[model samples]
Target chain A: MADFEIRDLRASVEGKEILKGVTLAINKGEVHAVMGPNGSGKSTLSHTLMGHPGYTVDGGEVIFKGQNVLTLEPDERARLGMFLALQYPVVVPGISMTNFLRTALNAKRGYDGKDKTKQVSPKEFRSLLKGELEVLHMDDSFLPRYINDGFSGGEKKRAEILQMAILKPEIAILDETDSGLDIDSIKFVADAVNRMRGPELGVLIITHYTRVLQFIKPDFVHVLVDGKFVLSGGPEVADRLEKTGYSEWAEADEPAVLKPEEVA
Target chain B: MATVPKVDVGTDYKEKYGFFVPEDYVFKAKRGLNPDIVNEISWMKKEPEWMTKMRLRSLEIFRKKPMPTWGADLSVIDFENIFYYLKASNKQSTSWEDLPPDIKKTYDRLGVPEAERKFLAGVSAQYESEVVYHSLQKELTAKGVIFTDTDSALRDHPDLFKEYFGTVIPPADNKFSALNTAVWSGGSFIYVPKGVRVEIPLQAYFRINAENMGQFERTLIICDEGSFVHYIEGCTAPIYTTDSLHSAVVEIIVKKDARCRYTTIQNWSTNVFNLVTKRAMAYADATMEWVDGNLGSQITMKYPSVYLMEPGAKGDVLSVAFAGKGQHQDAGGKMIHVAPNTTSTITSKSISKAGGRTSYRVHIKMYPDAKNSKSFVKCDALLLDDESRSDTYPYNDVDAENVTLGHEATVSKVSDEQLFYLMSRGITRSEAETMIVNGFIEPFTKELPLEYAVELNRLIQLEMEGSVG
Candidate 1:
């Protein structure tokens, strides 16, 4: 029961369904990748799992550990050990990355009131931040800069990884984390995720290309097409889809993916 | 990460500023207002012939004008009972050593001297009705930079003071402005010579150290062609049993090809009613920026305004308002584009927590002949608790068809998911709320000077305490 389970879940954004009945489970101690072509609900699935306000759950349930996540708010779910590395992480002006991380950390601690712990001292927090920066190869100035403001493509992804490292959420869903990164940046972020993957950590990496998976080496790969997972297999599936593209899935989901020719 | 349990002060935080008002100070006039007191204030200032006449005229206007029916309620304002002027010190001090000890203590408590020693190029400390300490670097003064108290400017550089004072905002501009014009006291006067740029910012710290006192500061800034200057003004008043009034009038003139930025942060005690009139004008190719923050006051009504009077000129105003219980922060900006190719942007962020009220009232107008003008106004509000109230009222008047105008506003409550996310990370509920609130006002805080921004965030955190169950 110490795992994330989605059972035949369906969701939609703005009244338009983007996630069909689907089932997937990721237990603690594994890295799973959901790869698909554009408009295949790959990103939507990730957002729905995180309970993005724009996405509404129409059916099924998402159980994080034993609690039904659908009953919880996004921040509540996050406090429940879920994190999302957004495809386009919001650029919040005026909020420094360091300050944002500190607030998030304190919020998580508030729930675990059982431990009578003192707030992290500024000195210790700064040093811990410095250590995280060193691991991510980020500059010291990045913390003072506004969160993701004026950040380049690679820097934004690196920032997301740094947040994941700091908060250390139990279940991390990285949505298109490798979309705009160069090969080197992709390698760095993938390595960061790999280093974070352990028996105590579970990850759901959402991406369109198989490039990032090459380094992260997911334990499982799933093909999401037309709002539904058409196939699920081991890491080899990413290679097959990368070579053939979405043509086969496009033909198979003609009814589910496309509308019938309208009367003119 | 560890969470610090919130300390329950049981309303003791409100009492922290209880002694902010000094009791021993003698009252020059009663709490209520009257024409006799206005005349007495004029008599005390020992003004020039024309200045006294202007004050009498302003007083007459104030008497005849009706209280504003819009915005915050003024029924609580007993004009006849409030003193027009109360001088804490008889003379202005050119150096810190000459200032009265208590006044100096006030500045020391507020860290004005430390701030000056660290970053400020010049400092003006106004306590009660006069400047107790004023000084500027000789290098800046030698560069033709003029910085002094407004009254001092009127006495020494009358020509410069007369040219810009009341030009941007006239005495009859509004009732509060008229009241301020009649009883105006200590405020900063700055002039950046043509083609001269001030490297470090000039700061003015205004404090109301006496009880039942009304502070009417008049500030004037003139930046000549090709010149640049950044001025910051901050105000703090001790909490008092009876309400105090702070009505200030600020006028700025940014000449052609020059730039000026005026920043104000006010943290008045919950009992003070702050009514202020601040405006600026920009000439051809000039720029004017107002970065204002209003965090504390029982009732605050301030709108930093800009008039883009020449083509190629620009105006930008960014403001943030936080209203806690029993407080009403009605603040925003006004942008008037009167020339072709002019542009203006106003971004306002407000937070209303614990049954407090915040309103964003903005106005953007482009003249009929002003072609190619553009104005964008965005107001965002975050409601932490259900009892709090927030409103956005923006007016966009575009007479010129060629102008592009846009206004967007959104009122959002703290996202539960965002809160839960922070909690799972080991942060407390209060800390989570603080993060969301900070993020909501990041646009405004980032625009403030570093130290000022830090203080603003800390104050917000303090106000958000006990907000979570």
Candidate 2:
């Protein structure tokens, strides 16, 4: 069964529609990539799927684990095994990474009780975090420091990936994960994301570049233009996007005033 | 990575530290202050004649002093309605078993005895108006460390108490100071011999139990030459319909080459007006540090100050304040440079939520003879909602040359981006807010002991829960 399915999902921001009927589904053990041009409602889709309060779902439903998740809060959807790697990780000045990660993990486990036995053990958590740190080529010394405080752009991306790895969600979405990264940092982040792949996990990567696909290959690629997907194909579509760019679909969703018969 | 216990804050403040034991006092004075009441307080304690004279003089000072039109509003503090004195017991004991059953139940409920036995070097507990239980580690006592309540220090170590008492903070320093001097009952008093280093911290816990009661505790600590000691104070009060007044005076003297650290974690009920005066003097090459956390009270006006008295002296103040609904927290620190080659730093952080208001008010002064002295100040404030408010009132007077002074401040509201980011990680809204707040004050909390840090985090969690919804 598919872990996530969106049926004609329509969303808006500030009374203006940004996502016009987006439809996609990701089943278990499948990697899907959504490539879109600028202003194509790419981030709107990611945030709306995660139930961001700023975005309003005007119509349609998002079915996850046999439940319509559009009515739930962001945290509720998150605990239901859906995760999103924010493109711009928030800078929390005084909280350490260990505290945030442990809290998130335990929260997913539904361990809100006072009984420590039900929660993740400190030893188990430390080992899990240490392994993820090794995968990301980061030292354990970063654990005690504040999360994303005074971190470089590349470091922020890597931290977001580390959060995804620690949560171990059933379905995870990466929003513009490779927007701005140097050569070495991109390699480290791609390698970490690739290592997190499993036969049971559903992966979705949204990006504007195909360079990241060279490391973490996608099973299916869909092109989104003007709030609607225009093309769907295999991994070769990313290569085609790199070569042809997105000018062909600048107005693909709706024909211009000059071209009346082109719509038919 | 230890799991944080669940906090029962889905309710109001009445559930935590707000339960009151029935009023049981050996001697409950009249419901007003006068010369006769002051004399009766002195006579009830059997204090020396000189102390009685000082109390009367302080009473006159209290009456003569005018209320300054500054800081948090104090017109709500009706001095005529406050019970000036309530003697819980005349028999102060060194053992908890020897205490009255009700007072013992109060301490037991607070977990004071268990905490003192396991972690602290010494402990003094004040119930209504006097310290009822006292204990010090034998090893520390053997090292010539004098650890006792302020009243006993006056009777047992009269010469030492007379020498340092009111020396750092004079009676006329402020109206609160004058009131504390006149009716001060229970506070910690410590005297460390020269060169003796007491590694563990000494603590005192005070509580106000009666309605409209006024608690004035006087604390004095003398770190002899080259000696080192850390003193901590914690306070709480029961929820009362009428306002309670808690005015305290703490004085410290760090002698030549000595070091002293004084930490206060004040968590009174919201019906109390906590006006305090705290000051310390550091001699040549000595150091003084104040770590204060104010998380309670309807109106709190306190500014812990340090004076770099001689050359090579150093001073540091790190404080945090949290003002919840219907609360106003006016808190900061003061540093005065009097000698050359002295250095001081002040860090203040405040958070206001749910129509609460917090302000950082500080005074920094440097004299002409304080040449080549350095001072740095930083104050940061956070507002959780549009209804909350924050302000900064910094007073700097500098005259010395060849000195470096730096100040930086930032006011912020919890951003939607930060909250969404944490919520997307499966943390609830209130939990995320508490986490962010805990992080904002991490610098101050990291300086505390492990157990204290955990307790503080829980307290912050309780406060943040009320802010949301």
Candidate 3:
């Protein structure tokens, strides 16, 4: 399929099934909102889609553009236009944000078969870093600081946006990017995401609340309950569920999300 | 006692024709340590009374003090069977062009002259017990910087050498220091004038060309007020069958607002006992950093230390040790903060493979008067397989209650998941292993110069090839 599609995808962690076979597809330029309550496999779906080592894909396929994402490494998937703004971004010490960004950017460039030249000089790198930081309203010194070290909630979310801006991935999966933000911070994050939205970009925003949708309104809404997509509808579904709650979806016994080939 | 090889190689040396020195290349002391040998060594290099007296006093201490029991066992060192001094050539050359063909070939293979021409502002090449080639930049000498060998420093500037010689670390400091004090040979003597900073680093290259030989190098560095300088030293020995002893003592003094960085990358062959004592004193607002790398050698017991003696002083030690089969690298750092507001940081990383052993033993102390002081020690060990061993024994004696001290340590083998990830990306298993190993030592490698870091990475990759399947 040319669209970003997850066909009956199921996954597990530590021998316990967490993501029951859930399926959804989004065309280019479509902004999809994955809304669900706690223990509803929302975060697990994002991680499984990115092929996180902790989450094993037991079945089904995560076909992005055309390739099976389940067959790619997380970094490889990242290079091929898939991104996960982790709910809890892992902190890798001694590796600066600027350094990590440069490496990731180069990896993507290699995947895209772009200019295979010497590294950008320090001056150019710093200039680009300054430009990106100014866009995010971040201080210049933040680039040299270890990735996500001592970052406030809002700063970390903004950092995630900055990464997305610099990387320019084809598909951006934001996991609870506005979970811990105040109204002003959430609006700022939503505005940043909206700025990144374009005809060629497919945004998959995963969240339990519809607060962020108030700014960057989604075109499609998918209800992921018990690890399977029990229901799918338009953006109004987010507003309807925000008021009615997930009680109706919780009553149904959905089939496992994983395909047989994914399970060992 | 094992005999020194007739046709020698340092340490693990073997004898094909019994013990005998090459006639063409002159100067060989009697195969023993005594007053006669000490006097012969000093007199052979030419006269300097203070140094001769210092050597005799060190010899006495070496005789009186028993072998050390705390660190890597040094009972294997046979004092009587070892030659305290061995010279490959007759005279010292201030330029590489003046060196003999045979000696020049050795330095050429080691890339000393090329390194000197490219990066270093000065060079000292010690072949056996004597300095064969020593030179300093004319501009560095014009600024009243004194850069020469230890014996020359004693001859040229006796008072300056005597003032700080035994003050920081005395011969009685340890058994090896005492031995080095007794028969100490060629090492660097560096002095930076007040307010002067040497942009390019000065380097010393030591080579041991004889077997059953003990190369005791004594170094002294003095940085005057507001001055800054960095010094680097490296050592290598040919592979042989008999054990050689390398005991070096390095003393550094950083005055008010001065900074000094001392780096050492040692890769001796398997048959060597490397026991070195390196210490530095940082005065008010001064900084001292030690970047040490240890690879190869039979058993190495080196703990470079820094003493922050005045307020606002800082000390840092970044060290990495690699131990392969038949190697025991016992290396770490010691930080003693005696003044208020002083700070120190110690980071030690080590790798062990093929049944090798690595021990990171560090001692940090904050004296009672050292209020508001802070010290952090981070030690990490990487074992390639189950057979290899790593140990972290950190002793913290913090008497100052107001001081902030943090100590963390971790030991882990390579992860299979990470390997699989790399392998699935079209990287071979060996390349994946190398990448993981490089990443593990990334913290240390990032601190080195570009070329040295690349060389070290390649060396580690080579060492890891047969270590794992």
Highest DockQ among the candidates is held by which one?
2
TM-score of every model versus the real structure: 0.69, 0.87, 0.74
Ranking of predictions according to lDDT:
2, 1, 3
Residues A1-264, candidate 3: write the lDDT tens digits: 547888888899888898878888877788999987778888789878877677888999988867998998776787678777777765445556776677656555662223547455577667877876776678878888766779888888888887877778788899988777666777777777888788878999998777678888999998877777767889878877766677676564332222244322
Best by TM-score: 2
| DockQ agreement of candidate 2 with the native complex | 0.69
Where model 2 places Cα greater than 4 Å from the true spot, the runs are A115-117, A250-264, B1-25, B89-135, B205-214, B235-243, B467-469
The models' CA-based lDDT, in order, is 0.76, 0.81, 0.75
lDDT digits (tens) for residues A1-264 of candidate 2? 466898899999999998889889898678899988678888999999999889999999999988999999889999999999988888999898888999999998888846677699989998998888988888888888798988888888889999999998888999988767776878899898887788768888998767678888999999888778888989988878776777577563331111223212
Q: After superposition, how far is residue B48 of candidate 3 from its true place, in Å?
A: 3.4
Q: Highest lDDT, which number? A: 2
Candidate 3 CAPRI assessment class: incorrect
**Which DockQ-derived CAPRI band holds candidate 2?**
medium
Q: Which portions of model 1 miss their true places by more than 4 Å?
A: A1-93, A101-161, A167-190, A197-264, B1-27, B89-140, B206-214, B235-243, B398-401, B466-469
Write model 3 residue lDDT over B1-469, tens digit each, in one string.
Answer: 1211122333332254233334353665468787877876776666557667877888888889988777677788888988777663321213445433433343334444454421121122223323432234566788888877777787788889888887888989988899888888768889999999988777664322221123787889999999999887773322222327889899999999999999888876567899999999999999999999998788999999999999999999999998888789999999999999999999999999889999998999889989999999999998988899999889999898799999999998877655544332233456556666777777887877776786676666666765311
What DockQ values do the models have?
0.28, 0.69, 0.11
